[model samples]
Every structure is written in C-alpha cells, then in structure tokens.
Target: MEGVPGSSSEHECDSNSLHSEESKLRLKDAIKHLEQLLLENDLVAPESSGTISHEAMQIGQDLYKSTVEILGSKMFVETEELIMAESDDEEGQFEEIQDDDDSEQYMLPEKDKSMEYIPLDYKIKVVNMAKEHPKWTLKTLHKQGCSRLKSMKHLYRWEEDIKHGGTIIDKYSIINSWTYDRFVEARVNYQQVTTRNLQEWALSAASQFENFPFKASKPWVIKFKKQNRIKQRKITKYVTEKETATLEEILAAADIFRKQTQVLIPNFHKDFIINTDQTGCQYQSTFNRTLSTQRAKAVFVQHKSSNKISHSYTAQYAMTMSGKLLPLVFICLQEATGAFGSKVKKAVDEFVKIYQNVKVTSSKSGKLTTYLYTQFLKEVLSPYVKHEKFLLLIDSWGGQTNPALYDDIFQDDNNVGTCTIKVIPPKCTPLCQPCDVYFYRQVKNLIKRLQNCSFLIEQKREIASREDCIKIHAIVHHQLSAPIFENMLRYAWFASKLTDEREVFMNVNEVCFPLDILKKSCDCKNVTFIRCAHCRANYCFACFYDKYHPSTCTVPSTSTDE
Candidate 1:
C-alpha cells in the first residue's frame, strides 16, 4: 500500500488484485509451454513421433551413458546370481538350487540312500550302447540302472552314470561346458532343475529327440532369472589382475577369429606345410580328408580356475573352422561327427597333427603320435617372439612336450644360440591365455546364428535325425563360408593377436583392434600389422596367377547353393 503512491486503503485493494491477476496469467503461460513440450514428445499422441522433448532426451542420454559405463564391454550379461555368490557359505551351496523349476517329480525311492550313491564305472557300457544305436530313449536310459537325478545329491558324482548307457553325449556336453562355479550355478540359480536344453524339446530336432539323460557334452544356454527378470545391461566391471589373460584378450581374439574364419573355405596350407615340414599331408599313404576345411585337430581348452587350469582337450578334426583364437570347431565337430557316420581313424589323425614328437619305444609302428605343437611354435611364432625370449604355455598332461620346441627352433651346424620355453605355472593358464577371457563373446554369437537356422526349419523335424543333421550341417557350412565371418576370424587371429600374450609383455592388453585395422606388435616391440585385401576373405598363396584359393574349401559348396 505504501508503494502505491496514489492509493488509500480502498485503492490499495484494487491495485493488489490487479497484480495477482498478472501473476496468474504468467502461471498459465508456463503451463501452456509444458503442455506444448508433452505434445511435441508424442508421449500422449498416437500418430506422432520424432518429437523427444529436450528434458526427456537428456534423461535418456544419462541412462545410456551409465549403461555404457557399467555393461558396454561384454556381449553377454553375467547372471546376477554369480555376482551374489560371495554371501553363501560352503555348506549351504549344495542345497537343492532348482527344486521349484521342474514340474517333473523324482520317482527314485532310494535317491538319498548312501549305499546306492556309490560312484561306479559306466564308460564301456555307455560307449557301446551309443555306438550301437546312435540314439537313445528313456527306456534305454532306464535299462542301465543308473541313478536318476533323485539318487544323487552332487552333480560330480554322476560321472559313473555317464559310463553306463545311463547318460549320453548331450549330458557330457552340458557337464563339460560350464566351469565348476557354473556347475554350482546350475545347482543353485533357478527354480527348475538345470537340464541340457539340447535333449529337451526346445531345439529344432525335436521329433528326432535323442531322449538322453541330462549330461554335459556341449555348451548350452543356462536360462535363469535373477529377481525374476531378463536383466539387460551394458557396462560390466570384471576383476582385473595380471594372473592370466583377461577376458578382453579372449574376446578380441574371438573377434579376430570370427573374422578370419575364411579357413572354412580351405587353404594352400597343406601344400605350404608340406613344403614347410618336408613331407606329404598324409601318414602311411593315407591322404587326410579331415583338414579339407581349415580346422584344428583338437582345441586346447585350458580350463583355468583359482590359479589353476585343467587342460581339457576336445577333438574337432571332422569339425570345420569357425574361429581360430576362440574355439568354434567344437560345436561343429559334435554335429558333423555325429552325422555322416564319422570314423575313428580320421579322429586320431587330427590328434596326431596337433602334437608333434619323435618316435619312442612302442611296438605299434614303433611310435605313438603325440601332440608336441613345437612345429607351429618354431616356424610361425619364433621370429615374432619378444626379446629373442618367449614364454610357451601348455597343460600338465603327460604327453610329449615342446621344451625343445621353444629353446632351439633355428637349427644350424655351426653354433645354436640360447632359447627359452617357459611353461606357464600350473593352473594359471586361464589367467595367462587371452582366449579364456573372451570366448563367450563370439561363441554365443555363433550359437545364436546357428540357433536361428535351427528355428527356421519345418516344425515336423528337429535335431539329431539323419535329415536334421544334414540340414544343420548345410546351414553351418553356409553361415561359416560367408566372407564376413571368415574375415573377422582371420583379422582377429593373424592381425589382432600380440607378439607376447603377457599383459605386461609390452602393454599387450592395451593394444586394441577395430574391425578396420589391427596394428601388430612383436618383441623389441617391432610392429607388423596387416589389413584386408579389398575386405574379402579368400587368400591366395600366389597373388596373381591363381584366381581362387585352393579348391578344397570351395568344393562347389553344394550346401550353400542348396
């Protein structure tokens, strides 16, 4: 009232009322502006789009950045139960983890009885039955008198069940697929009993169901919900230390491997290796058809856990190359070997090719072949090693070793310089090998790719039938034979890999590779990196003369065309 110079008590009331009206008009303008923003955003409009509000966009950007900060590096999200495992005591870990998941009831009356749970031998019986019939049903599984899931309390004790016709390859694949911690996860993570998804009616070859007991034979998905939801994430903080190769190395390797896998097409490697080795690609006048497509005879899966790695060897001779650094040949081999009625001699040749050795006192040809992979170490890896000094990693298997493989690779009549073959400390391979850290990446992608094919088939058929095997094999060959996947494998293995795998071995982990270029490194840290030739996967030993690579992998690709 004092500020209104011309106003007395009556006039002051009118002036104050006008001021309040002006304030109400400003508030109405503000509300109109907000409503306009909501309309632009289309949050309330059915036919509107491309109208994100500035405030809303900012919020979304913040969420995306947070996700990248936490989960961006990995292709797969770690199930939360694995993260929460620290809170559980050892004794409580073994309690039934999935009692609520399966609707099926345990029928065995003596399941928990001590006497019936004795571990027994069953390999011969199991092998014979599988070899004889190629597939099994619940009736056949029951004939073996193997302990049902009700009979055993621990998963490890089921090894005997695998021996008899009680368990089949699918179960073995499932068991071997997970790390020990994952086995504990299988036991603890869900409401349902974790069974092999392959044998269940989930996959494509359902009508041809092998009706096998749940066993770990190959890798399969373990689907469980943490707090009951499919947790989507982008950023992951993995525990990092210099114990072994980090998961980054493995993923990068797989990325390289996935890209470089044109080896599935075939190679001049047989002829090149023949020249390199001064011998034919055959032993005893037998030409090996196994390597027709570029592939490893056996994958050295150095299963590292708690500062130790158990070198679990799986053969993939009949398998085709899906990748080099991260393993892809395993699943393919399991499928192909099961199909086409694969043979044992071909399998053994694959074993012999991986490990090299001199003859020993054996009546069987006076020599038994062993995997002393010193040759690849000597010829290909030697010149690229660090400081003229390098580390050789191997498992604690009692097979012929490659100590000599590393030490004196270059032979001379005059004088041989010193060399070193430093095997990584036992059980430390997972920490040391780059492959372990990154396998799940491309491995899952590859599985997802294969799963896509399986799902596309007619509903009348699924996996493990004579027809499904052929169809899946054809699909696998087509996907792998594609140039994109093959180039990734080649780029990752030959290009992305480091001269020394050690993290401290010249800051190797920091040496990252994009899909475009991989800057290679060697000891003295000399670098030599390669790029794609027109971004195509096919490689020719003779650049100009030969139009196509070796005709072996290119064998008309009837499957791809089909």
Candidate 2:
C-alpha cells in the first residue's frame, strides 16, 4: 500500500512492455505453425513467401528458431512427420471424392464409349454383323449388341475397304499359290483360264481361307483388275517356230532385186511393181453377232442353200504397188448347166461387161490349177505388162512357183522382157505378202458385212445362188474399186517391204487394158477345160491330158482317148 518514489510507474511500464512482447511472440508462433501446415500440404509457394511483410517474416523466423530450440531436433522431426501424415490423409480423402464424381460421370448411360476399350472379339463380331447387314450403320451395329464399336468413322473405313475388293482375312498367300498352280496347268494342259475357271478357283480359294469376309463376285474380281487377266494372246507354234527373214536379209534382198530390176528396165516406176493373191469367198452368209435373249440357250438364223452347198469361189486379184486394182478372176465350183449354173454364167458375163478385165472360170473344186495360173498370167498379166519390164510378187504356191509357168512367161518370145517373178518365203505370207498383210483382211471384212446386210436388210433366208454370190462379189468389187484399193495397195507395199516409201508411188497412174483389144486377144475358148474336185485343168484334150489328170482327179472323162 505504501507508494515508493517512482516504483509504481516503473512497475506499470514494465508490465505493459512484457504484455506487448508476449502478444507479438504469440502472433509469430501462430504464423510459423500456419507456414508449416501450408508447406506440408503444398498449399503455399516458397516463391510467394517474399510477398509477406518483412516484420512478419522476421517474427515467424524467430518463433520457428525458438520452437526448434525448445522441442529439440527429434521433437521437430516428429512434428513434421505428423503434419505430413495429416496432409496425406486429407489429400487421399479429396482424391476419393473426385474419383466418385468421375466414376458417376463415366458410368452414365448417355456417355459415349471410347474405341480404346473395344475387344478383338467384339470387333470381329461387328465386322461379321456388318457383312450380314450391309445397309446397317455403325449406330445400328452398336444397337445390335456390338456396344464396343461406337464410332461410325471406324465402321465406314472398314466398309469402304471391303466394298473395294479388300478382304479382312489374309488370303493373299493362298491366292498367289492357286494362281501359280492354274498358270502351270494352263501351260502344260493347253487350258484357258476362262471366267468359269476363275470362279471355280475362287470358290476353292475361299474354302481354304476360313472366315473370308467378302463376296467373290465378278465385280469384286474385276476390282482386282491388275491381278486378274483377260484377252491375253495364246502362244502358238506358228508364232514361235515360223521362219521369218531378218531385217538385214530382207533389206539386202530388196536392194539386190532393185538393182537387178533397174539394170533390166531403166527408171522402173512403182506402177511396174505388182502383187497377186487368191482368197476364197464363201457363198453362204454369216453373222458375227446375232440378236438373242441373254437367257436363251441358243440362237440361229436361217441357213441359206449356199450354206448347204458348201461352195466358195476362189478370187484371184492383182494390184499394182501404186494401188491400181485389176479386175477379179472368180473361179466358180459349178458345171455349165442348171439354173444356178446359168445364173452364175450370166452374172460372170455381167461382171465382165462392167469391168472388161474380169475373168470367170469354173472348177468342181474352186482352186487354182497350173493351167489356171498360166491363163491368169497370159490373159490378165501378159496383156497388162505387154512389153514393159515389171516385177511380180507372189506367194509360194505350188502352181504359182511352177518352173514351167515361170519359163512360159519369161522365155516366151513375145514376153522375153515382160516380167520377173519373186516368191515370198514359205509360211512367211503373213509377214511378207502384201495382200495377206493388208488387202485380204479388209476384203474379207467387207464381204462379211455384205453377207450380213443381205440377210438382215433383204430378209433373205434361202441359200444364196451362184448368181447371188457373183452379184455380191461384184458389189464388193465396186465398193472396193480401183480408187479405194489404190491406197490399200500403197499401204501393203510399204508394210511388206516391197517399197521404201509410199510417197514414191503416189504419182503412178492405174494400168488398164483396152477392153476391145483384150477381148480380141483372149483365146480362152480354144483352151481345153476339165473340172476336178480339188482343182481344174485347162489343158488340150489331145495334149497334157495325163499331166493334168493326176491320181487326185475326180472328174469323169467325157472325151474319148483318141
């Protein structure tokens, strides 16, 4: 109770100062604890610690130091461990809550499934389903129990691949094996790989591959166009073994022939070069294709009488390298009797009237004989050539290459400088014969077209008579007349190596015999004529009878052996 001098004031001041210091110390401890908790939980960043006031940071550091000193290093370590364990527990709880939310979101039926979870079994099922229901979309597949296959993009990709000849099964190795086997079979057995063959092979191939997931239709096979083959040319013995003159040999021969001709006839023109060939035209009409139902077993047209007769006329045509087509010489296979025969003769007369160079002869078998060949040379070639030195190209036929015929033409006193004959190599007609190479194909095609026209346009079903055949020939002749065949002649000459250039022969005029002179000079009637089944002989009844009527002669002799 006694008031000492300045003692109360000093005591009060000391107490106030102690209380303020205590408050500051408590605040420091709380901040330090807060920082420790934040650090343990990874909620506070060390980098952001500098944003706190310097005074507050200093107080926190001092409290942390004092606490570390009081509790010792072991106690501090224990406290840190406790804080970390609590923080870990809290994090585990939060993660569990988040996982519950995520599970609920994923489990919802409305959520779209990802393709990552699709099993191989499910993918295969979907593919099989798609095959069964080709019109179904991916959503449809999913609705039909393929829940794993969710995306239409994946489904469309697979569908497109299969649609365009792609297969889900790996059967390429098997296909290649079968193809090689079939190829060998074709090579050894002379078999062709037809569409049916391919279909059969495809069925076998599909059988080998279990679960082949595509239709093996014609269109599907066609899609693999590079793999499947069509229209391949068959390798023939003739193509492989046929003897052809080498380019060098051909060129050399041509040069030698040219030099020899130039020596014999100075400045020999292209018109002087001539080629002759014989082709047969059937009297019967034929069609390449006819109108018929696709399902029909067979289609037929009316068979003409010509078809039953099996008669064909061997037409011998001559052309200059310059393109001048001479009149055709038609050898009919008929006797000079009956309506058909008379009609043939009349038609031949008509042809002769129109084209003065035309010559008609008949044989039981429409083929050229030695006598007929000689007649062609004398009647057709000799008058055309006259005294002009000419080159003649002919195929190597027995009658054409006869030494007697050659001698008769070249050694005749009047024909001493008339012509020279060159025989194309044997079996090389397709390569070397100008007529075979260019003219005959076009001629045959035109004849076929004419026959078709006669049947289809004229509606004639009866067999064409000899007269009709002659008329057809005449029509074809007029259509492919001199002017038209002239270009073909040039092309043939160029193609057959007979001429160096078509341009060199463009200016040559057509060579035609004067009708009056030709008619006066012809002595065909005086020549003896006999018909044979295989060929005809134009020999005098008094001479060359034995020679003309060989063992193959089928004709009965009408003349006595006097």
Candidate 3:
C-alpha cells in the first residue's frame, strides 16, 4: 500500500511535467469550463464532441491562430489539433443556438472583451488541452491580476512605449504589457559570450552586494544560476578630460560666468541667457571595456567621473502654479539641423540615424557641435506636465518660444492637449538657475572621477550612437550608491528644493484661464502680475520675455514688490 501511494504520486508528477507550459494549462481549463457550462444548460453531451466546438469552426480557427501565435506553429504541433477539434465542436453547439427561433436576435462572439484575442499558439493550446482533459475537473480558476507597479524600470519603459508607439503594425499590446516579457536581452542593443569556466557552469549565487555600488555596463553582475548566470554589461566610451587648458576649460565651463552674472544681477531668477540654446544631454558615450574589471569600487568611481554631460538644455519657463515661478521642463534634444522634412518623411527618420550612430541615452554628447536643447519629455513626463502649469526653464538663447507654438501647444482649441509655459525673464541666474547651481556641480564631479580611472579599451575607436552604452549606464546607475543616483535624477530634471515663491507668468486663458489653474492660483489673484498688450490675458512675464515681447514689447519695469 505504501509503495502504491508513492507510485501514484510519481504518476501525478509525470502528468504535471508533461503539461506545465501555460498554453497546455489554458487548453485544459477551457475544456473543463465547457463541460460544466453544458451540464448547467442540461444540453445533451455530444458522445464524440470532446471539449471542442464543432458548430463554430471559426472559433476553432481562431484558436488555431492563437496557438500558432503563442507557442509558434513550429514548436507547438499538438496544440494545433486541439484547436481544430474545438472548431468542429463549436460548429454543433452554434447551430443549436442558431436553430432556436426564440433566441435573442443578435449574433454573439464566443468570448467577451474580458476574454481577449489570444495569439494562435495559445488558442490551439487551450483547444488541445480541452480535447484531452475530458475527465479532468476544474476545482477552481484563480485569475491573478496585478496593479500599482512601483518599479522605476517598469514606469520608464511604459512611458517610452507610449511616446514612440511601435515598429511595424501598430498594436496596443506593446502599450499594454499585462503579460510581462522579462527576457534578459530584450532591451540590450548588443551582447558577447564569455569563456570563464566558473561562469560557464553557472549557478545562481548570492550577490556579495544586493545592488552593485557603481555605474557601468549591464550584466550589472554575472548573475550565474546553478546551471546559468546573468551579468549586465555596459560599454560607454569615456571622454577622457585630456589635459584641457584650465583657462579654456574655465571657458568651456559655461556655468561660472552664468553664476557671476546671477549675483551681480538682482531679481536673480536664473543664469546664462542665450538668444537660443541646444537641448539633450551634452556628454554621450560609445563601447568601453572599463566595466569588465571585477572590482566593484573601481567601476563605481570610473562611471561617476566620466559621464560629465548635462541631461538637457535649461529652458526657463516661469510657470504660475499657486502664483509661484517654478522652473519646469528640461528640453533635452537632438539638433534637427541635418534633417529636412522634404528629404525625409519623419522626425523619427532624422532621429533614427542618431539612434545608432550616437550614444542614444537621455544624457549625451560626442564632440559638442551645436549645443542641442529640447526637452525630451516622453509619455512618462508628458501627462504629469500636462496636468500642472508646466514650464521649461532655460537660458535666453533658445529663440523665444513662439507665441503660436504656445497657442498651438497649450490651447484646447489646438487639441495639443493643454499646458502653461512662461519663459523665465532674461538676466536672472544666481538664485534660480534650475540646474545651473545643483546639476553642474554634480556632473563636474562625475567627470573628474571617471577621468582618473584606468580605462580598459579594445583600442581607441570612435563610433556614433551607442544604445548599448546607455543601457550599461542605467544598470550601473541603479547599482551605485543612492546619494550618487538621486543627484543624477536631480541634475537630469534641473529641479531643486528651491524655486521662486513668486514668478511673473502670462496667466493662461481658458475661456480666460486653464481650469486647474482657475482653482489653484485664484486665477492669478484676479490681479495678474503682467498683462499682455496684444491679448486679454495676464502677460506670462517669462513667456512674453522669451517669445511674444522679446523684440517689441516694453521692457519689464523693475519693482522690488514681493
């Protein structure tokens, strides 16, 4: 009896091993449910119609399509037969439903929206399982769902997908990744295999550190399983600070003069006013071997130093949120100088070349030509920005943001959604250079640190666009010490704990002002700071300074009033 019990357990284990894949389980579940449904309706059980539908062959076809899609036709043969059988079974049941003259006068699909379009392979799997699982009873069906995903990785990915749409046929599945694809290499642009024996016969090992304390290549660590290992590898070519002339470097250091100008000037809102400025991170990278080093501390130091590029061009938009001048929106961009609309059809085509040829991360630069400056606000940032009075803080260099651009972007009539922008008034920086004060110092530190680390290079060769390079930085950035990375995000955003309590913005007009602001700022106190001479609304002091009034409007009268 004891031996018999053990033998039964073995049989059960064997059964499960044979049908562990998700497709197989789904098929089993479908058939079990069908049988129950038929019993409830008191329908005659087809002696031959095992769990599949013969009446609606189309349903079976659909299942076959799903099966071929989920498991692949080449990989899942048995799944195909089950789907075909279900199609035949559906045919009979469907006919009976159609024969009922008193039935509801509408044709209905087999499944509702809750039950969605499954790929061909998955559909086939369900069909086959049902065909084979006649005697198997479904004790319960527990559909596990999830929400409130907090991982920064997931949040960023969702935002990126929303902005770019997708490659080839546009489907919402890419937008909706309910089924997570955690493939190790899905996001990486390039990879290389290794020859180490310990690495070869890999077993998952307890990491000496929970997070790698440095920024470097992905394969962040060689996460080896008992039989396999995973290591993140990053390959960014470090820009060696080759003996830059201290005087020239001081000249290269754009932040110094901006700071001095800020203190000398009062109302000191921000610094470095340019007629126009470039966007996007300044320092970019390519492949590097610096990461292959086994020491954790060394990698961390190397990464912190060399990545001295800024995240975006500082566009100063004085936003009226609660009557406050908030510096918002870092317009990081790639110059559109090389792209012409008539020659190429899309902004994407112009960007595609840079995607491969240059380091494509949010932070970038390789021999700075024209200083790029456009906020790289993708899906993640857009919605939040759209919600509040979103403003971009930048130097005066970015040609005054066109009023038409503002009208086109911020007005509901334009359907550009809705936003508020106020270009920070020119000649203010000591107290309010969004990132100028905080971010510059941080990048300078990182640049200096990486400069000292010994770089392991295959050889000195420059390549444009290195997506893999950025991937590595992101991975290492995650592993590095918290103080370091938080600073990185801060520098990227050009935000600080401090912003002016009172800034002059051209209050947006809804019928007169945006609804959210209507509630938030008391409609700019019903008494606005500056009024537009051209329009009825309050003059967005910052915006008018940049776009509408730069060339023609009267200069802002200086007043010490808070």
Rank order by lDDT, top first?
2, 3, 1
Among the numbered candidates, top TM-score falls to 2
Q: Which candidate number has the best lDDT?
A: 2
Error of 3 at 444 (Å): 5.1
Off by over 4 Å in 3: 1-337, 340-381, 398-400, 411-418, 447-452, 455-562
Q: Give Cα distance to truth, residue 117, candidate 1, Å.
A: 54
Ranked by TM-score, the better of candidates 1 and 2 is 2
- Over 1-562, each residue of candidate 3 has an lDDT whose tens digit, in order, gives 2532122332232233345678567757666655543443345354655554555566665654554343432233331122221111122111111223423343333332122223332222222222223222221000111112211122233232222222111221221121111122122213233322122111111011112122111121232221233443565643335422232232223345334433433432232111112222323332232445566655432233243323222222222212221222222233345323453335434443433212221223221222222232332234334533333444544443454544443434346544333343333221234444223333323322222212222223221122322322222222221221332333222222132222111111211222222232213243222333223234332343223232343433332111
Ranking by TM-score: 2, 1, 3
RMSD of 1: 28.2
Given candidate 3, what's the lDDT at residue 370? Answer: 25
Q: lDDT values of the candidates? A: 0.28, 0.49, 0.29
State the displacement of the C-alpha of residue 318, model 3, in Å, after optimal TM-score superposition: 14
After superposition, candidate 2 runs with Cα above 4 Å error: 1-267, 306-310, 334-351, 354-357, 410-417, 454-458, 461-463, 482-485, 502-562
Q: Summing lDDT over every window of 10 consecutive residues in candidate 2, give the lowest-scoring window.
A: 505-514
